[model samples]
Target: MSDAQTDPPRQRRERKQNADKRRRQVLDATYRSIVSNGLQRTTLATVAAEAGLSQGVAVFYFKSKKGLLSEALRDLYLIYEAHWQEAVEAAGDDPAAQLVALVKADFDPKICNPAILSVWFAFWGEQKFTPQYGEITREFDDNRQRAIQGICARMLPDDPEHAADVADWVDTLTDGYWQNLHLFPASYSNRRACNSTLRALAALMPEYRDQLTPAD
Candidate 1:
């Protein structure tokens, strides 16, 4: 192949990798900035400093604080969704196992890291500044709720309505634990949280008690 043809494809790949790297760097810095300074206090300059990149570069990529925050929120939601989805898939075909995996995934270190969790709550707590935050989070919640509801339906073949109720309870318990883990790290244990969630699952669906026991 001609150098021009071969070089263009290689250069394009390199450029894409570099662009992706820079975007991830900024997004990570955004998470750290929000965790450290709170969402309202986070700015392009703060993120740039955290990223060791110039504010101009941050601006070039994300345009403004609003844009940056929206992207960061979306990125974090996608990461969370991906983790649980992967966990559920790994749990095989048993609906009970899938439900257990879903609860455990919420506390998985990859998605439950304090810094990332704080960034989520920061965006969640801010109701007025950006509607994008609400939109992104609602999408995440809706999808996760559907996944849980589906699993509950499979587990509770006789009563579909009760399945939904159990799903709601499961979501509420996991969310409460997440808040506890974020707000009261002094007394919170991830293993305990997972155990508590599994216990609640067992109570909700006693028939599946054997399957709901915490694996850890």
Candidate 2:
């Protein structure tokens, strides 16, 4: 056998790892392109250029522009999920505290960037025409709603219905923030939004109202 064919199995495994790493690098570059230029302008060649890889090498991993976009969206969701987990953990033991922490993290500059937000909105706009995008978007939205519902359940055990209601209400408020961030930056101040959301949820559950109130 030729020297290339004589390589050990471990060498083959290492090659696979390298390939996967390159694929991820390409995905990250594609994400940045989509964020900066929008999906319409993010061609495969553009992503390849961003990744500093040859176009043929990018095509080997992604196959098509759509495939690259799909992978990039999935990667973005995974990154956000990790951030969400960290925010939840930092909130400590109190469910009310957790709820407030989660809301604040949504608008925290460290956690939320214009590029990330722009990519999300772009994917959301394309969801209507793209079945894969639609499915992923629905899953993402449902997961977020479920997280809020779980937090509400913990905070308002006696009033389960109120828990769901409060969760939905908070979702509405956060969604509004996403819509008006550029138009009314001051209107969506993280601290004020968090307090207002907590207050609104508290009104729905008198049993937890005092617990959710900020300390003087």
Candidate 3:
């Protein structure tokens, strides 16, 4: 019958949608579990329970606890990448503007939070066991440094060597601030951290100092 024929296709479509939904659900649950329980205590059982899914289903989706946590890290990395990419585009062609935008993107409340920061630190700690990368490839950190270096070179055409050094400082400073957030969540404020970064950057890139550190 027509109803029977259409029902199978509808069910197939639904099955695909459900599969995607369940995968996302599990990853989100895994993130929450890691945030709440810490990587040491988080397990397949806990994530599955948080997701309201069976351990068997979690295993089928991700294959193992490692797989589950890997996917969660991947999700966070993509969000981080997209935020900065969009920030750069919005800042247009000015290297100084773009650099500032990219730096500020890290402190955006949407992605920068205690929960997410904790998850990042968790994967970092497990770097010995896992590949320790998400959507960001092994070269992403290098690429970002290169991008910042290039920007500084453009801004200060005379001192390319110092520009590269400044890029390294920026990269390390950014990482340190994020680690601070993870390490001292109670005392750290994203706004305060970002302001400190902006001040340091403004000092480092003096040509763009006033512009980078706008009044008020």
Please give the range of 10 consecutive residues that has the lowest summed lDDT in model 3. 132-141
Instruction: Give the best candidate by lDDT.
Output: 1
Q: What TM-score goes with each of the models?
A: 0.94, 0.82, 0.86
Q: Could you give the C-alpha RMSD of every candidate to the true structure, in order shown?
A: 2.7, 3.3, 3.6
How far off is residue 76 in model 3, in Å? 1.5
The CA lDDT of each predicted structure is 0.89, 0.79, 0.82
Q: Mind giving the per-residue lDDT tens digits that candidate 3 earns over 53-118?
A: 999989999898767777777777777787888998899999888888888888898878888888
Which regions of candidate 2 are displaced past 4 Å?
1-13, 182-196, 202-216
Candidate numbers sorted by TM-score from highest down: 1, 3, 2
Clashing pairs in 1: none
Q: Which candidate leads in TM-score?
A: 1
lDDT preference between candidates 1 and 2, better one? 1
Q: Quickly count the clashes in candidate 1.
A: 0
lDDT of candidate 1 over 95-169, digit per residue (tens)? 999998888898888778688778878888885667788888888899999999999999998999999899999
- Cα deviation of 47, candidate 2, in Å: 0.7
Error at 68, model 3, angstroms: 1.6
